[model samples]
Target: MYAYTALGGPEVETFLDLPIPEPGPGQVLIRVRAAGVNPVDWKKRTGYRPAGAPVPEVPAVFGGEAAGVVERVGEGVTDLAPGDEVFGQTVTGGYAEYALLPAALTARRPPVVSFEDAATLPIAAATAHDALVQLDLPPGSTLLIIGAGGGVGVAAAQIARRHDLTVIGTASPAKKDFVESLEVVPVEYGEGVADRVRAAAPQGIDAILDLVGGDELETLAALLADRTKLVSAADRATVARLGGAPVERARTRAVLEQVAAWVADGLLNPRVVEVFTLAEARQALRRVEDGHARGKVVITVPA
Candidate 1:
């Protein structure tokens, strides 16, 4: 199997022919049909490891979420069997022809949902759903999202709108039109972001979800009356200091099932603006790493 994986740190990531990984206990292997490209895929190569992620064994594949048909199941995994169409976080890196997924974290992909769309739900859509559930705001309340043009932010904005919350999102000027299309009040992130957010939400923000952390998150924090509602997915330590916590991700199959259902029912769209073949995975990674993608970018693997 061919895998686009990290051969070394920084600039050494490349594609290579590798052995197909076997599923361990409570895991399943799938013939990857589509893998969602995310910023973390590239960041991991730069030595920015997320907590609990296994240390990269040379040639570590470059993706986390994937959608495909099950090929094999490990011991203790029974709910899913061979031929099941499923999507979830990968245990064997998703940027390959085949990958392993923890069975408990995987969910069936609805027939109405395409592999490209299902691939985006495991991480982006699931995080958005988790963030909103953490905020727990009611209808008619105003919710402000920082960095709303990226994959998770875009999902959060649309899902918030659907739940009857007035949504305001911040993104680059280039994404203003696209952000507005999601029915979110678009605020350009820049020198005067605070002013723009204040102007957009005169009723005061009921809660805030921050995807772009750092000084920008600090700037937005000042505008909120209740700091407790502030949630950050980027800088956990910083958010903790600001009296806010990181987005408590559910990371469960049930969450994936819910988001997949939303996509299948047309209630939520991952808005996959770009699709690349596995051979073109570099271009796909570049698009997300360069912060140029307005929505989700996916890499498709052929049967």
Candidate 2:
């Protein structure tokens, strides 16, 4: 099997003859049809890994989300089996011909959903749903999302609108028309952003989900009537100091299923704007790393 992997310390290259990893207990090996590319993949490759992420062996496979047909199931995984079409976060790397996904985190894909779209749900869409659930804002309340042009931000805006919560989002001028199409009041980040948000939402912001952190997180924190309502996905320490917490993730199989159902029902769009082949996985990673994708990027594996 062939896969794209991140070598030690900022090195990413393709491995054309990697051996397939077997499914372990609570895991399933899938013949990947599509994999989602995210900023985290590049971050991890460059040593900005998430807290407690295991230091895998050199040449570790790349990607975290994928959708495909199950080739085998591990112990205690009874809900899914060989030939079941599923999508979820990868326990093994997703940017490959075959990879492992935790059965508990994986969900059966509805026939109506495409593999490309399903591959994006585990991280971006799931985070959006979990953040909204954590906020627990009532319908009609105005919600604000920082860094709204990106994948997770876009999902959150659409989901919020569907739930009847008005959204005001911070975005780049390049994404102006796109963000507005979601019915979110788009405030361009930097230079009087707070004032722009204020102008967009005269009713005031009820809650905020911050995807861009650091000084921006601090800037957004002041606008909230209740500081505790702010959730930061990027800077946990900054959020804590402002009397808020990090975005709480459900990280459950149920969340994946809900996101998939939303896609099937036309309530959400994964907005996978760029599709790359497995051979072009490096370009996919580059697109996400460049931070200009403005939508989800995915790599497809041919059977």
Candidate 3:
């Protein structure tokens, strides 16, 4: 087996001849066909996340989202058998050609969707759904999504539109047309962002989903009509201190299952902007670290 491993700052290497890991109790072995690369992968590679949690162990596999066919089922796992096509977030080991995931977290992939598309949905789509559904906003309510051109942002925009909300998305000038094509009002993300948003919705925004954390967040805070309407996934502590709500990512099979169904029905979509082979995982991380990808980046592993 070949797996991409992160060795300290700015270093990722492909290790060949790594032994395939066996599934433990309540886990299943998946032969990964496609893995999704996210901003967090780069952050981890660069040591952005605080140390102390696991994954610092050398030769650590670094992907969180993946879709593939099940190769073997562990003890007590009866619902899924060998050869089941599944998708889920692996706590570790997604970058490998074969990885282990707890049976509870894996869901059967929709028959109509490809592994590459299914690979992109677990983390980004689940986070978007959690943010929108947690708020319980009524149809016709105004929803604002900051950083709308990124992977999570694009998914958030589509979900907001499906719920019948007046969706507003903020992005760079280059992404304006793409965001607007999703039926989201596109505004530039920098100086005067709030002013532009106000111009689009004079009555004020009913809900805000902040994906970017920085000066833009402070700007977003000022535009909210009420503090409760502000929700964020990136910076929880900052959002809480500013009297806004932090949207937590839920690791549940049910959420992934629902998103898969929506994708099958054409109500939801995961925009994949780039694809790379497993050997090119380091370059893929560099692209994500550059912070300009329009959507998710996927890595295909040889079957």
Candidate 4:
């Protein structure tokens, strides 16, 4: 199995042939068709371990979500069998010819959804869906999404719109047209960004979904009347100090199923702006790490 591995840090990632991983109880072996590249994927390579998740061994495979054909199922996993088209959150990694996906977290891929689009759902779309659910604002309410040009932000904007929320998203000036195409009011991020948002939404932001952290998040925090409506998936400590909460992700097959349903129904589009072959996995990571990708970037594995 060929996959990209984290060679100690963000500065290094290499492709290698590793032994195919076997599925244990409650797991499934997937012949990966596509894998999604996300900010966390690079962050993990740089040593950012999610809370409560163990640090991976060195030269760890570098991906978080994938979509593919099931090659086999493990013990106690009776709901799925070989040849099922599925997409899900990965317990190990997705950047490979084959990988293990926990059966509980897996969702069936609808015939309407392609492998590339399904691949984007497990992490990026799932996180966006979870973030919107956490915000819990009613229809017609205003919600602001920071760093809205990236995968999660783009998905969040579309989901918010579908749920009838007025979306105001922040991104670099380069993404103005792209963001607007999703029906989100695009605000340029940087100095005085809060003022820009304020001017755009004179009624003030109802809820804020912060994807960019540091001083920018602090500035956006001021736009909200109720700090509890503020959520940050990027900076936990800063959001905590501001009396906001980080995204409480629901890593369940249910969430993936719902999200996939939306995608299947044309209610949500992942806007996968770029696709790369596994041989170009490093370049895919580079696009996300550089923060220049307009939407999701995916790596397609050879069959």
CA RMSD for every model? Answer: 1.6, 1.8, 2.1, 1.4
- Against the unseen true structure, what C-alpha lDDT does each candidate score? 0.90, 0.87, 0.83, 0.90
TM-score on alpha carbons, each prediction? 0.96, 0.95, 0.93, 0.97
**Between candidates 2 and 3, which one is better according to TM-score?**
2
The number of the candidate with the highest TM-score is: 4
Worst 10 residues of 3 by lDDT: 1-10
lDDT of 1 by residue, 27-135 (tens): 9999999999988788777766656767777667789999999999999998999999999999878889999999999999999999999999988999999999999
Tens digit of per-residue lDDT, candidate 3, span 1-303:
334355456545555567778888888889999998888766666555632456466566778889999998889999999999999887556777888888888999989988999998888999999998877899999998888888899888899888889998889998888888788899998889889999988988898898887788887888876888888877776778778988866778999999999999998878887999988877777787787678788999988
The TM-score-based order of candidates, best leading, equals 4, 1, 2, 3
Roughly what TM-score does model 1 have, to 2 decimal places?
0.96
lDDT (Cα, tens digit) per residue for candidate 4, span 174-276:
9999999989999999999988999999988899999998999998898888998999999888999999999999999999999999999999999999999
Lowest-lDDT window of 10 residues in candidate 1?
1-10
Badly placed stretches (over 4 Å) of model 1 are 1-10, 51-55
TM-score of 4: 0.97
Of the candidates numbered 1 and 3, which has the greater lDDT value?
Answer: 1
lDDT of 1: 0.90
Candidate 2, TM-score vs. the true structure?
0.95
lDDT-wise, the better of 2 and 3 is 2
Residue 188 alpha-carbon offset, candidate 4, angstroms: 0.6
Clash number by candidate, in order: 0, 0, 0, 0
lDDT of 2 by residue, 1-303 (tens): 334355443345665667788888999999999999988877766656556667666566788899999999999988998999999999878989999999989999999999999999999999999999999989999999998888899899999998899999898898888889888888899978888888888878899999988888888789998986899777888888999888888989989999999999999998888999988887788888777887799999997
